[model samples]
Target: MQNSDSDFFGRQGDEKILYVVRPHPLATTAALIKIYIISLAIFFVLVVLGSQIRVVSSIFYVGLQQIPEHLPGMR
Candidate 1:
């Protein structure tokens, strides 16, 4: 596979070097599937992390709000 990319295969079909991720589009289908799978996993992980952060922050805020109740002079 030469790096010149004269008649590269594209996602649509054979194209003339418009853009070349790979020299042959034969691997495009598998590559796209892999990319989708990886992205989905990352998305789910991020969602879970965000929810956990929200829960923790809410608990911290609630603790702060209850501090005045424990103070003798502030009551």
Candidate 2:
């Protein structure tokens, strides 16, 4: 009787330095699709966050520049 580990852990016999895995076409396609979707979503989120940071930094810089230079201490 074949042990269930073969199916559970993939084909098992001997460990090779480099081995090829031939998965089902549908499985490969589905996995690639999911990776692409997740990567795209992450890319979009980063873009939005970067835009928000840029806006906030610009506002902070402008406010700092607007501060009065003539404080009544070291004059």
Candidate 1: Cα lDDT at 16: 46
Model 1, C-alpha of 49: deviation from truth (Å): 0.3
Whose lDDT is greatest here?
2
Backbone-clash count (model 2): 0
Best by TM-score: 2
lDDT of 2 by residue, 1-75 (tens): 453433434555675436446688999899999999999999999999887763334654666655356743322
Instruction: Estimate the lDDT of model 2.
Output: 0.65
Whole-model Cα lDDT per candidate? Answer: 0.63, 0.65
How far is 32's C-alpha from truth in model 2 (Å)?
A: 0.3
Each candidate structure's count of clashing pairs: 0, 0
TM per prediction = 0.40, 0.43
Q: For candidate 2, what's the RMSD?
A: 11.3
